[model samples]
Target: MHLNDLSSCSSFTRRSFLRSASAVLAVGPILTEAHFARAAALDAAVPEFSMKGIHLDANENPLGPSEAARKAIADIIPNGGRYAPPLYFDLMKLYAEQMGVPVDHVQVYDGSSAPLHFTVLSFTSPTRSFVCANPTYEAGQRAAEIAKAPIHAVSLAKDYSHDVRVMAKADPNAGLIYICNPNNPTGTITSKEDIDWLVANKPASAVILVDEAYIHLSDATSAIDHVKAGKDVVILRTFSKIYGMAGIRCGFAIGRPDLLKKLMDYGNSPMPITGMIAAQASLMDSDLVTARKKLIADTRNDAFAWLRANNYSFIPSQTNCFMIDVKRPGPQIRNLMAQDGVHIGRSWPIWPNYVRVTVGLPSEMQAFKTSFKKAMDTPAAAFNEMPPLRSRRDGVVV
Candidate 1:
């Protein structure tokens, strides 16, 4: 039967007709012509894609999963058939001993992201607000949105480090303050003294949420010790970065027992047995952590030197990722490199001329260099032009 004739001749019941109409309307245009025009402008701003490219876009460890972690996962495969075991507590105890905090001070979860979300939900209510550095991880901002809490994003300092002073002053009634050490995108660290100053000067009612996702890669000290000292701080540590267990998805939060208990009111689910086993094994493999960290440091240093030699500006980084100032719109540069089989990172709306790149292996870095040069050598007239860059703050690009 012809589809047009079928639609015209079919007689339908009210419910059936409603359902068919709803199905068609569901996929109806949500984006207006103006929206498409804006999107096309954005697409023009981004780089082209290449199939054979190396991906350094996401800050993921190219060398993932230690041998021991893999073995532990294999050993625990049979246990997934059963309900989640009570290994989380045991793992907590091990982490406590290692970190020198009590078991009550630790909350294990699938990943640090859960604890981060829970912390935001638990602390920031409709009246209270969340304060964070601009250009930090967007997860906490998203959580505040879900909780209907206002978010105050203070711009980072000129050096790309968190301006704790400004952030503290911006939101006196902030319920939660988020600090990502070795801050994402820029890969810069805020000093411990600066953090201490923020804590000391912050509103007494506020709680500090320190995300140590990239701490192990940096030389700066952790705020975890402050948590142990009974500060109003909740420190999150993840096995994903240093242990190369991002896939396994295991991380924990360390804070005072009372603060930790508050997070539990949000409820805690049992940790995945396989994930638990992998985390425990990764923790045990101290040698693997040390070896991999050194490798990352050496490789990152080499990449930094190359960037300097090529006169590409970058934020000096202590972490496994850093931002390269491409002297053009980042999305455009990224697309161009993608076409050459090298996918780098997304652009920071705050830093339009910069592209963040993860520290890959030696060969991957070489590919990035080659792809980057090729993209730069190509004329600007060859690709679509993006809108003028906007800052995370009010200032024009320096």
Candidate 2:
């Protein structure tokens, strides 16, 4: 718990968010929607009809929840009147059993995003900076902003994996280091060994936050072993991806009890009964992870093959989403594709020409291919003029 050593960092005697913590906690939709609203100001050219069209923009599980999860949600609807705290404990126990960790180490949340944000705010401050890979997930960076923590964005390694060495040395006063495994957008994995090295070598006061949101979709090893070893590490897991419970919203933050306690300082609320019961039911279904993993991988590989044959340059990915270098302004292309009823993801400023595309069902992907080809074939002059890319100090696309 080196990062938990508060003496090493500046004390926040007068923080703005502390007074309005309740409002921040209550406005869950704002926190949740913040991830996808980057293009709202710039999306005037894209018709509203695009929302009703093929949605490959968000890395959502098109499969929705598993049958068991759906049944569990339906079964619990009647009991929603009561605050079922016991169900949260049940889910914690179940997850602990499955992951071979102590029950106290697992804290339930509506989704992984809460824990991610809490970890950033809890560990970082203006003096204790946040470090992360460039072009990785931006949610934690948002949290860092609220904390007024300086952010150090280190570039990825040549293979698209996180450059843990550079990240470890990014700041001597670093408080949090975030690593999104099978990273979002790129869908590439940072090796467990690299993460372990980072944990062992990072600034003594820096806590390593490993986001395993996409772990089930890839073969990358989990960082739970570090947490089990009592290292200053926190792991975030979400049922959003493989279990297809994105909308249902159940996730866990596993770490030493003390580390989790620090996160509770910001806000603590009752876990959604629907999310908890659905997660429990999902865990009970042993075949769910395996079935969905194979399904997503098969579909992803097929798309890769198509990209190769069509001479499209794209990053090799292991997760359910990947980035393709459309060789043009990504938003321009995204808008072009949306006009044809195929909506893809926005680009990171680090690589403006690349756009992320979620892996949908085979038919949806086929539609994506058709519309993607059409969008690419359309002359650049045909697309509407886009506003200059605006971003925060940390390079988060705004």
Candidate 3:
């Protein structure tokens, strides 16, 4: 029967029930009425809250927009109608000076992701390749797929750090090497020495793309200095992280002028006027970065302590996020937490048993603790289970 006809019926007729049963049979055993009914029941049981319940999933700063940035955005509201302002060039100059690079070496984009995509598009081809850690940011790999470029994923080190040497050795013909420092999901840093070695040993024609999106939250060194040294390196930095301006979406790329020009040929136009203003103001408001870093560090440490106390296994992270081995499929635990009004982040297909959690305020961490404990208490048979393993190399599940 048609959907409308079924809805119009007050009760199921014998013929309709037979048709439904046949349709269900054709679908599969997994889609049984009982399974769907239980799913619906779980959905109905989930609590709905008005306020964002301890939003720790996305690694966003709970303390949002700095006063300086807010004021800059407010001051630029009237100039929205006008075409791109000269502030773009000024911001470039400021960032270049701060980074100790020439103005020609820096290019601004809507966000670091733009430069990242553009770089992949500009360089990689079917003949060329992209090399990255298995569980690093997947955006570049996705971009490579769009470009039909071959990708080589080197597993992370035993301590959940990027194995730069292994990545450098993966594909000598690689057009790009993408590294997310204080990597997403795991929030671990690849040592500067290892990265420097990669850059030094990489094929002369390849360009290394270093993503510093979370550098402000960690103690790790940045690769920006390598860019200034005229290496074939593109350092991507974003105001989205510590600046609390993810919504504003302002980020930049720093590299040798020649390499940056290649990326610019494929880059998008200037950023929005308001975003430019907010980014400049944020860069100038250094205090906000320091304060936010302290907040994240304190809360993250507390959460880590709790996890340790409870004998939970996790990658010790220096950034504002980290991955935990939930000892069961991550999606199952994620679903259970969502029912408790806590939506955690996703699990990678490669690391099905681990879930990445972002650091939020203390209260949010407390909520995470409670929800995670409850999730762990769930019956093993309730979720797709994995054997408890001590660790995986580079945090990649073997």
Cα RMSD for candidates in order: 13.3, 6.9, 15.9
Q: Which stretches of candidate 3 lie over 4 Å from their true place?
A: 1-51, 382-398
State residue 24's C-alpha deviation in candidate 2, in Å: 9.0
Candidate 3: residue 101 Cα off by (Å): 0.8
Angstrom error of the Cα, residue 207, model 2: value is: 0.2
| Candidate 2 TM-score over all chains jointly | 0.89
Q: Candidate 3 at 397: error in angstroms?
A: 18
What TM-score fits each model?
0.83, 0.89, 0.82
Error of 3 at 130 (Å): 0.3
Q: What are the clash counts of all predictions, listed in order?
A: 13, 0, 2
Q: Judge candidate 1 at residue 347 and give its lDDT.
A: 61
Residues 210-286, candidate 2: write the lDDT tens digits. 99999999999999999999999999999888988888798888999889878777675566789989999999999
lDDT of 2 at 316: 93
- Top candidate on lDDT is 2
Residue 15 in candidate 1, Cα distance off native in Å: 47
Candidates in descending lDDT order: 2, 1, 3
lDDT of 1 by residue, 128-195 (tens): 89999988776677678777899899899987789999988877788999999989867899999999
